[model samples]
Target chain A: MSNEETAGSKPSEKVIELRLPSRLGYERVAMDAASSLARRMGFEGDRIAALKTAVSEAVTNAIEHGNQHNETMKVVVLLTVRDDELIVSVTDQGSKSIDEAYVSRVPNISEAMQKDDKGGWGIWLIRELMDEVEFTKAPGGGNQVRMVIHLER
Target chain B: MTTTRQHIIEISFPSEFGYEVIAREAIATFARCVGFDRDRIDDLKTAVSEACINAIEHGNKKVHGLTIDIVGVYDGNMLQIDIADQGIQQYQVAGAPATIEEKIAGKAPARGMGLLLMTQLADEAHFLPDTNGTRGNRFRLIWRERVETLEPEH
Candidate 1:
C-alpha cells in the first residue's frame, strides 16, 4: 500500500484538517485528536501525551516561526491514517525557515529547556516526541512539516 | 492469582483551565503511585499539561459538551496513561507535514518538534486513529516507569 493509505479498506482512510490561529484557542482541537488517536493506536499512556504535546509544539512553531504569529496567515495541520501508522502534516504560509542550528546544538533536552533560554525550543520539543520527521517547501511561498508516529506492534 | 491495577478518569470541558487541571490531577495521581519525586512529578505534570492543553485548545477547538477520556495503568514498575478525545470537525487543519531536523539544524525551517519533546520526556511514543468502523477519532500516550523519590519530611 502507499504511504497515505490506512491499513484497511480503500474507503476506510480518514483525514482531518484545521486552521491554527495565533491564539492558543485554535490549537486545542488538533491536540485532543492527536492524544485520542495515539491512545487508541496502543501507545502507552506517557507516549500518547508526548505525541500530543509534539503536535502542539509543531503547530505552535508553524504559527510562531513559520507565520511569525501573524493572524491573517493560516496554520494548517493534516492528520491522515496510513497503513499501521498515523501521519500528521502541518503547514504554515510564511517565509521564515526553521532554526536548525539552534535546535541541533542543544542535543540535551535539559540544556534546551533552560528557563532563561526562550529564543527557540518549540521545534526542539517536537523533534523529541515523534518518531519520523520531514520538512519541505509548500506549493506556494510557505513551509510544510510531516511527522510520523507508529502504532504499537 | 494476581489482580491488575487500573485507574480511570473522564473529563469534559470547553476551556483551557479544565485541561490544565485534569492534566495536573492525573500526573499527581500517577506520580504518587509510581513514587515519583517532586522534580519528576513537576516534569510529568508539565508534559501532561502541555499535552492536555494541546487537546483542549487545538484538537477539540474549545468546543462545549466534548470530553477527554483518560486511563492509567500501573504494571509493576511501569506506569501508563491514556487520553482520548472524540473528533470534532471544527478543529481539523490542512497541510503536508514538514521536516523537523532540517528546520532545527538551519538546513530548513522548524517542524515536528513536539513529538521530539514528548518522546524525550517519556520512554516511548506512538500514534493511532480510532477508525474502528466508526466515525470518530482517538489518540494515545504511552510511557515507562516514572522517576521515584522519597516522601518529604513534614
Candidate 2:
C-alpha cells in the first residue's frame, strides 16, 4: 500500500496538482494543500508558515497580474514533494505578461507606503522566504513562479 | 457569502492508495472558506477521502497510472463537487448492490456500503454519466449554503 509512484517528474518526486479559479480567496486552497504536504514531510512550524505565505503571494500574483482577475482563467498549483525539499509551482493562464524588471526588485518600506497601491512586495517576499526561487514563462505561455524550501531535520 | 462571483477549484492526481490526505485537506479548507461549519467540514472530509479511495479501488482493477479529477464549485449559495476518475469500469459489490447513478433510478437505496458516508454527509449525491467526451464514473455531491439543519440519529 505504500508503493511510491513518480508524479510526471523524477522518480522520487510526488506531485499534487490543483487547478484553481483566478480569484482572490482561492489562494487559500493552495496554501492549505502545500502546508498539508509540508507538515507530512516533517517541516517545522515556522517553515510551514513561510510556505503558506509564499504560496499565498504567488497565487495572488498569478490571479491579479497574470490572469488579470479573469474568472475563466485558471491558476495551476503544483506541489512536488521530494526527499530533501518541497517545490511549489504556481502558474496562471497569462492574459498579461509579467514585467521582468520587477521580478527581483527590493521594495523600500517608505516608498511602498507612498504608493497608492500597497502591493508589489509579494515577489520580493517570496524570494526572501524560500531557499530557491525562479520565475519563468510556463509551458502554457503563462507566468510561473517556482519556489523551493529545504526540509531540514 | 456576501461576495459575488463563483469559486472553482479543480484537483487531479494519480490513482494511488495514498494522496487522499492532500485532497481532503484542500477540500476541507475550501468548504470552510465557503461558510460551512466545523462539523460539516469534518463530515465532508471523511466522505471525500472515502469516495476518492473507493473510486481508485473499484475502477480499472489496476489503480496504477489512472487519474482522479475533482472539480468543486461554490456559488455563494451552494457547493457542488464533481469527482471523476479514468477507470476501465466499475466493479460491483456482492448482494443486490447498486452504483450511484442507479440510486437515481430507484434501483438501489445506496451506492453500496463503500459510499455510505458520502450518501449520509452530503445533502444530495448522485452518480452521473460521462459527458463532453470525458471518461470514467462521475459522482456529484451537493450541499447548500450553511443553514440550521437537524443532526442525524446515532
Candidate 3:
C-alpha cells in the first residue's frame, strides 16, 4: 500500500501516496491504506485504531464535503513517515476556504455532546487523535487537511 | 404540507455504511441545484453523511434486513434532510467539556462524535421521534443559503 517515489529512498523518510474516487465506498480503501502504513511504522492496537479513525474522518470529509461525491473529483492522501513522526495530508478538489469554518482548538466535547448536536465532530476527533492538525489550501487548488502523529519510539 | 418552494427527494436503501455515499451525493446535488455556494453545499454534504452514518451504525446497529430512509426537502433557499432508521434504541447525547482543564483531562468518546459533527456542519440538526409512533429514529439536518448582493446602491 505504500508508494515509494524513489526505490532506494532513505528508510527514515518515505512517502506513500493514494488517490481514490470521491465516494464513500472508497473510504474503506483509504482507511486500510492508512492502517497498513501505521502498522508498518510499529504503531500497535489503540494507536493503530486511532490512526485509522483519524484517516477515515479526514477522507470522509474530503469525499462527502470537499469533493461532494463528484465522480470526476478525487481525494488525494499523502503519508509521510519521518524518523519521529508521521504526517498525513488529505486533499480534495473543492476550492472553498475552510479557514473561516474550521475551529482551531479542540471543541468542548462535553458541552457539544450534551446539545445532541448532529455534526461538527469529525475535525474535533482528528485534532484530538493526532499530535498536530492543520488546514491549508492545496498546491493546485482545493483544500487540504494535514495531521501529524508523533512516534512513540 | 407542500409549498411551491418545496422540492423533495426521498431514497431508501439498506442500512449499511457503504450506502452513505449515495445519501451524501444526493444531498450535494440537490444543494447545488438550489443555487447554494460551493462552501454551503460542502457543509450540507458533511452534515448529511454524519446523520446517515449515525442511522446506519447506531440507529440500526448495522443490522441486516433493515433500511435507512432519507428525505431531502429544498424549500426556497433552505435545505432540510431527514435520515431515519428502523431501530427503537435511543442514544445518550452529552455536551462537550466546558473548560480547557476538563478537555485536557477528558478522553474523547468514540460513539458520540458523529452526532456532534452533524450539528457543527449543518445550520441546524436535531432528532425527532417518528410522527406516527413507529419504531424508528429520525434525524433532521437543515442548511440555509446566505443572501448576497450584487453591488452597493447609490
Which has the greatest DockQ? 2
Return the candidate ranking by DockQ, descending: 2, 3, 1
Which order, best to worst by lDDT? 2, 3, 1
Instruction: Please give each candidate's TM-score.
Output: 0.44, 0.84, 0.45
The alpha-carbon lDDT assigned to residue A129 of candidate 3 equals 90
Best by TM-score: 2
Candidate 2, residues B1-154, lDDT tens digits: the string is: 0233788888986677667778889999899887889988988888888778777877644456567888899998898888887757754333433666788778777545656557788887677765666557777788887566999999
Q: Give lDDT tens digits, candidate 3, residues A1-153.
A: 222233344554555455655656556655665665566667867987998898989988887778776745777777676767778899999875665556575577688778867677898899889899888889878889999988797
lDDT of 2 at B86: 74
lDDT of 1 by residue, B7-58 (tens): 3223332233333553455345445645656765666666666556656655
Question: Candidate 3: where are CA atoms >4 Å away?
Answer: A1-11, A99-101, A105-117, B1-154
- lDDT against the true structure, per candidate, is 0.58, 0.82, 0.71
Which ranges in model 1 have alpha carbons more than 4 Å from their true place? A1-12, A107-115, B1-154
In model 3, state the lDDT of residue B1.
13
Residue-by-residue lDDT tens digits, candidate 2, A1-153: 233564356766667799988768889999999998888888999999999999999999998889888878889999887888999999999847778889968899998888899988899999999999999999879999999999988
Candidate 3 lDDT, B1-154, residue by residue in tens: 1124455555554465655664566457556656778888787877787888788788888775566787777767788888888874665244541343434557554345566667778888888756777768888888877777799789
